[model samples]
Target: MPGNLIHFRRRVRSVKNIQQITRAMKLVAASKLKRAQDRIIAARPYANRMLSVLNSMARRIDPAQHPLLAQRDRERVMLVVVTGDRGLCGSFNSNIIRSAMNFIEDEAANRTLSLTLVGRRGVEWFKTRPWQVRHEFVNIMTRVDHRYAREIGKGIIDYFSASELDAVYLVYNEFKSVVRQDVILEPLLPIRRLEFEQESDTDPGVDYIYEQPPREMLDFLLPRHVETQIFRAMLESEAAEHGARMTAMDAATRNAKEMIDQLTLTMNRIRQASITTEIIEIVSGADALEG
Candidate 1:
């Protein structure tokens, strides 16, 4: 009985220690999540407005004038797969890698499918595969910046211009809320212009004068638009990663607490049984003495 009690006590102590680590991780993730969420929210307005203007300008121009706006037969493709640097985030990185691989497989027939892995997790996963890894940016999520986005955007632009890659896509986790994250697969290069279903009846279309030629303006704005999108994706992935870590740690902490409770109950039962045995033995001795 004493041995069993000691074992249960040790198990409970071990679980308590794990619970402390999990709780601390949860707190740290929560703090990072707040900062990441703020950046995403703050960036959305500017990006959206700029995208709207770019789309309007794109509709007014000729596709042949700009290589970025021109669409061609996609014989070669690239996937920019973004994932987290670390694990224990509860399938956050796995979902992204799986989605990207599925797309690559689906598009693999007769076409060249390449990868630009961004993050240590993604680089590790794709490196072992047979696909050609064109570029790798590890630990990029440690600090999300527009400079990195510019570099990535420039590489994509160059690849498309040189006809090295026909199309490019971005795959990452989009943050919906603290508990929910959605894996998003979106096209990045040979930029597509978005159109709305219904036009506003009360709005008079305003035409603005441009200092630069229309084609020159579009040429500059198109790259900036791509860089903006890359930056936004980085922000979304950061928030989603932190949210996933926070959720995983919370679940682990709860499980640890439950295990500790069960161990404590078991220890109490064993101690009670040992006391009962002692009481029964004492009573037996007294009766024998009286007899």
Candidate 2:
């Protein structure tokens, strides 16, 4: 009983140490999440305005005016997979990997699809797979910047212009809330399905006079729009990752506390039983001597 008590006491101590580490990790993740959320909030308005402007322009111009707006046979495609650089988040990286695999399995029957990995986890996982990887940007989740998005957008645009790829898509987690994230597989190329929203019931449409023709404006704005979209997606993914990590660490800390409590309780019970047995033995020995 004493040995068992000692063992459980040691277990309790170990769990307490783990609980402390998890608590620290949770706090760090929460801080990071706050900053990421702020960045996302700051970028949303500009991103929305960019989309609105593009929608208006796309409606006015012909698809023939811009290669990005042209519809081509979905022969060759690119899947840009965005994952976190690190793990410890619950099912965050695995869900993305699973979704990417599903996409490849479904699309392989018809089209020639390749991958553009964004995070270290995705890059490492896809390396073992048979699919071809066009590019990889690893370790960018810690410090996501617009320049990285611009570089990726430019490469994709150039590749599409060269007719290397027929279409492009992005797969990432969209941060919906602190505890929830939605996996998104969004189309990035050929710029299909343009929808613009009106302000009020009285407003039918708002028109603006452009300094250049619609075609020329599209030629300039189309690339920026793609970059902005990619940047936004990266920002969302970063925020989602932080949220997932924070939630996971919080759960882990709670679990550790529970384990510690159970262990301590077991230890106490064993100690008490040992003490009771010793007392009974001493009393019986005294009675035997008296007899």
Candidate 3:
């Protein structure tokens, strides 16, 4: 029993150490989640405005007038997948990867499709797959900015402009709230203007003059718009990852605490049993001496 008690003490100590690490991780995740969430929220207004502006411009421009707006029969397609670089964030990475696999499986007949991975996890996940990887960007979730997004956007635009790809799609996790995120797939290129008709309906009653020709403005703005959207998606995914990690770690910490409590109770009971046994043995020996 003493040996059993000693072994249990060792186990309890190890679990307590793990509990401490998980608690620290939970706190760290919470701090990072707050910052990431704030950045995502702050970026939304600018991103929405940019989308509105692009939508307005796209509405006025003819498809034949701008290369970016031109729709083609998709002979070659590109899937840009965005995910976190690390794991331990519950089902966040798994959900995105699973969705990507489903997408690939659904489009398996279309063998001309290429993949563009935006995070280390995405890159690593698809590395063993038979799909063709056209582009990859890693460490993007660490600090996503417009410049990085624009670089990626420019690559997509250049590829499409050069007729390397017919259509482009982006898969990412959209942050709905701290507790909720949805995996979303958005068509990025062949700049679908018809989809923006609902957005046009909500526009304020105002007209603006274009400095350059509308077509010329679109030529410049469309690529930047794509970059901004990609950056925003990265930001949203980062925030969602942090939120998921925080929640998971918090739960793990709580479970560890509960387990420790149960184990402690068991240890106390065992100690009490040992003390009672010792007392009973001593009393019996004394009685035997008296007899």
Best by TM-score: 2
Task: Write model 1 residue lDDT over 253-279, tens digit each, in one string.
Answer: 999999998999989999999999999
Winner on TM-score between 1 and 2 is: 2
Q: Backbone collision count in every prediction?
A: 0, 0, 0
Which one is best on lDDT?
A: 2
> How does candidate 3 fare on TM-score?
0.90
How does each model score on TM-score? 0.90, 0.91, 0.90
Residue 169 of model 2, lDDT score: 92
Off by over 4 Å in 1: 193-210
Looking at candidate 3, what is the lDDT of residue 69? 83
Local lDDT at 48 for model 3: 94
lDDT of model 3 at position 220 = 76
Please provide the root mean square deviation of candidate 3 (C-alpha atoms, Å): 3.0
Better of 2 and 3 by lDDT: 2
lDDT of 1 at 256: 97
